[model samples]
Target: MLRHLIARFVFLLAAICAPVLATPAMAATDVSTPWTDEDFASLRLISAQTQTGSSDTLRLGLEFELQPEWKIYWRSAGDAGFPPQLDWTGSQNVGDANILWPAPHRFSIFGLETFGYKNHVILPIDVAIPDRTQSVAINLDVDYLVCSDICIPAAATFALDIPANGNPDTSTSGASTVSTHAHEIEKFVSKVPLTGDNLPIQVSNVFATKDGDATQLHLSVDGLSNAGVTVDDILVESPLRIGFGAPVAVNKDGESNNRHFTVPVFGLNADQDLASETVTVTVIAGPLAIEQSRTVANGPTDASAQGEPLGADTMAPATGAGANIWLIGLFALFGGLILNVMPCVLPVLSIKVMSAINARDGEISRVRSGFLASAAGIITSFWLIAAVLIAIKLAGGSIGWGIQFQQPLFLTVMTIILALFALNMWGLFEINGSDNLGTAANDVINQQEKGGRHLSSHFMTGMFATLLATPCSAPFLGTAVGFALAGSSFDIIWIFTLLGVGLATPYLAIALQPRLAHALPKPGRWMSVVKAVLGLALVGTAIWLLSILAVQIGLGGAIAVGVGLVLGAVFVWARKRSQNLRPRFVFTALAVTGFLVALFAPGFSKPPAPSSVSTAATGPLDWQTFAPETIPALIADGKTVFVDVTAEWCVSCQVNKKLVLETAELAEFFANDDIILMQADWTRPDPEIADYLASYGRYGIPFNAVFGPNAPKGVLLSELLSRDAVLDAIKDARSTAGLASN
Candidate 1:
């Protein structure tokens, strides 16, 4: 912000005083300084007049010509980056100086937008000269940022001396020869936008549609009626999560040359809704641009951070934060059911099968109760997770699915619990209803062993299944979760509960029809073999978690934790069969002590292991590191970009890579030079990547999108990608011009 620059200018003087980049371009004129020689861009100072003469004002410009695909920010750089600042502290005979910013073009990539200038631009300035009779010396110290693939901070010193007016300066130039930048100065000076009433654009009317289920802005502009404007032709800037989307013409009046555009409001939350703040709106039409500001009328609203996909068709229609909960609920249910087959859920399925087998010999009523308890547990677990997410959302923190796996402490805890479960299945130690520690839950429900199994045991199984299911986003899960997370707390609860119910559908059906339990084969010696196999599956899960823990706290910590679990299992096995005096006390203490390393060894400070995406691995195709800001400029140059947002921890992402993205056919197609491939690694916590995901209303991985000259908003793929889906999306993105809807 300009205010930030002003507040910290004094502290930043040392850095600002550093010399500019050497090797400048040849001086354009005696009134102009040489351009700084930088690979990405070059800058110079140009004066329109060689002498101050009788004129009270001296005109100059800071001219910059950027290399291909490079850009600099406007006065208000959207999303990220800052504008250039000039310090004239070492100047003589200058009373004041003012910078006039040229109109900036909006860069649209993925779902976010930024404003800047590409190619060449000049920022015109006017100086107030109190004494035109005296020689005026101008020294400009400029600090600015330029970005292409990376952002580089640049500084330059430019000096231009204006000769004193003796004969009132002959024609304001010596020997009737004007400065070389005279024409360029006039060209950019005309490009500066007019302010206030001088601006051609007018906000004819501003109104908000606030209802129980909706909060939106309906704007009517006087000059742009039926001007054929798309969402790309406008830019919105606000310091809040919720914002107005691109203007869509709802009604047009050719007779009056007016357009009533309905703007979809996105990401509105409980705290900030753009209600009391000013929103800067910029409209771009060919070479003409105009900016205006309108303060939203404050009102009571139920808007939450959730918003429908922006630039959908025309209206981008949506109602309130809880829009289309019924559809979202159904999607969640189906997504949850599909989680039953995910790779991460395989171990839990074994545990589930063992429990089912043990209950097969029990009475039908007892079997039904156990299944019902498990189903209840799944729903209760979802509620617990939803509660935490809601709390984080309310407190303004980042929240995402499977994000818990990013924590070392959580990984350590999961590893120990899985190991213990494996030992129990291996018969290292037997747990009775008296031995159960579910006291808090036992009070509400009878946990006493009825038919050799307690309800608490079954309930815990369901809860664990839900936890494991999070790593791989099941089919339809991303949509349902994105919708849920983007909306109110109620939406999250509703969707997640439906997801739990969907996942527990099989259990619920068995509970409803107790006869299913009676139909299982009678318990036999084969059950023991099945238990061993199930135990192995759980042990494998523990191992996988250990590998991830190794990345978090180093291999040594993981080995120590693994050793502790093994020793703990050894003591547990001995406690069951040992004949020594005080064997129970000794074995129990030893087992508990073995598990202690896991509690204190893992550290959360270390980042997760780098994934293929993070490393930007060399493949058949030329893959670029994810840089969202550069996407639009690439598209402007008529190139297609395919972006894959993935993480190593995401099973679905690996599946997509093997089955769709890395396939021979798609690989060959992407290998084409025109097709730009960018991969983002989300293995570690990255605020930029998180914000990008949130922009699209997604909270999970295996995300894919295609951007091209035709598709400005890009084509969003599903969590699970298919060959046909990938081809169709890429083709559509490349061939179709401005396909606004997914």
Candidate 2:
């Protein structure tokens, strides 16, 4: 979201630094200039072929490699520093050298967000050759700000020559091409977002809105459908020098390929005229990058009062309230209620079931109290999450539901806790109050203390349930969370509270009617078997998290954690089975050591690689990657398309797959030569899938839709899908624009 709209703003003074101490020389390869060394950086001109043989233009690259901690700024350079300035005045036979900057990574240091490239970066520049038969002598003078703990301005000059006439060598793809720095230059060139009409991503609409002292940019964009890749952040390059913060997706539904965003405009007063201005909008979502020039228009003012994000005004309550807020609150409640039934929530559901069964023969007072404690736990945990999110928002950090799953540390801790729960469930270890003091009277005291301990555990159970429920987005939950995330702090706090209440509603209901617990089977020998079965469920959940860990870090880190947990489980089993105290002590020591590995491994491990690679669609159902833009064309051609937006962590999605889509009837229907099945996997966080789900105003997964001639837009399916619903929708989709032909 770093756009250098710096016409009026004063640029940071780039202090000239001392000469580059020492560095290894880089080979020129004839087509490229040797590394022009600087204090903390090296610059070079690189090209695949020096000759412009059979080519109209000479493709070249200006590459920079910085010291370990130094970085060069992007176009806008963020809150501090300036982008590199290149002067090609001394060049010969070069019409105009246009340097294309690749997308930059955002870095926040001491509360200031900056955009730049660290380590190595290449700015691909295409030097237009006016005369094809003339030799081009390219001379470049570059000045840039490179920063680490401090900012330093460095200058360097580089030169390269492209000879006139020689038959261009054919590349591996059998095309006349430049092949010197071909792969390296092409990679950097690809990083440069597509512009003009070539952009797959299209900005449908853009407008500016102002409220009080705050100005905002509202945008509508289309063309985002990439598997596992998240296309979220939007940057604005305005001709009027208007600065825009990173835009967040507005949870509101739109057309299939389109999504909306709201950006906070910096250094713009409410009095400034914003309409009719031209700006280049760059949307970066992992590998899917595109930019478009848009004419600004006026947009609808906020129905409610707004304030600057991360400002004191934001900390206060919003003055005006809208009816939609209430509706969102209701949705939040319903979403939370739905979460209890989500397949991913089974781990905690099992705990609640056990609590109910144990209470079946217990005192009514204890039953009510235990359930209330659980309810309280859920409510308290939700508030805690809200508080944290509020803080993050205030700090201008990216915030979202279920986003914590993306963190390796969070995944590691969760795996360890769940693994221990599984071990305890399997009777490997029994949690009791006394490690010692085995006196008869102390035993009586322990018995007396059991009730209170059970209640506390019930609360913990509710908290754990809330944590597990995050990965499953129920229908209303996504809308409510999205609404809150985009709204004032009050909205965030209030909506999340409603969601907590909604999720705890069932628990509250059971508490109100203690007789319900009495209806369940009383405790018996059968309970132990149930616990063991539930233990397997937790183990499965842990394994799923580990797989995500593998994706986050590397396979090696994930294996380290997995092995630790498995060994810990084994040690627990031994400790319980062994009769000797000495053997028990040894088992305990070994178990702690094993569990510690899971605990500390992620913190010590290196971070995951800079990029994530998502593979092409592969499945038995002939499921292609979900591309909503392609749907209209296929439907135009009389083909029926079924789009399934699902995530790996979504258990309900798996259930729907087993019961509906993957069923023989639907399978055969989708396998039809005319039928196209597209699946958007939300196994990893994906902005496109999220936006697609939001378009229908449905947030939670297990989302499916069918499109055809009759249902050109799409026919939505139930959240908890059924086989009949799937077939009926497909049938409806296939129903004729003219007449039913299938």
Q: Over the stretch 1-742, how does candidate 2's per-residue lDDT look in tens digits?
A: 0111121011100000000100001111346788888779888988855467555677788788889999998987777789999899888999877878887776666646567898988888877888877888888898888888988888888877877765443211222233336445655775787677534567766777778878878876666642223354677777555566666566543334555667778877546777888888877765557788888877643322122233222111111134457768888889899888877776666778887987898778888888998899899878877876666445423356665565566677677767867776776755222256345545664575455543556776677678777777677676688677755689889998999999999889999999999999868899999998888888888998898777766778889999998888899889888888788888878988998888678666665543322232334577785667678889889888888876555667777777777777777767667788888765554544544554454445567788887777688776678777787887877845423444
The Cα local distance difference test for each model comes to 0.70, 0.69
RMSD of each: 20.5, 16.5
Q: For model 1, how does the per-residue alpha-carbon lDDT over 1-742 read when each residue is reduced to its tens digit? A: 1222232222122111111110011112346788898989999988876666556788888889899999999887766678998899989998789888776776655665557898989898999998888888988899999987789999999888888767764432223223445545655765565446434456545556666546677655555435332222555666675545556665332333555555667767655455657776665554345678877655323222123333445432122113346767889999988888887777788877887787777778888898998898788878877877776555444567876665566667777778877877877854322224445444434445544355666776787777767788988899899878876788889999998998899899988987786687888999889889888988998998887777666778888888888888888888878756477668878987998765566642344454435543435656787878788888887678998887656778877887777888888878766679998876555645755787667887878899887666788888888999887877766744433222
* TM accuracy, model 1: 0.56
Number of clashes recorded per candidate:
3, 5
Poorest stretch of ten by lDDT in candidate 2: 14-23
Candidate 2 C-alpha error for residue 335, in Å: 2.6
Predicted structure 2: clash tally: 5
Best by lDDT: 1
Q: Which pairs of residues clash in candidate 1, taking residues 3 or more apart in a chain or in different chains?
A: 213-320, 268-304, 306-486
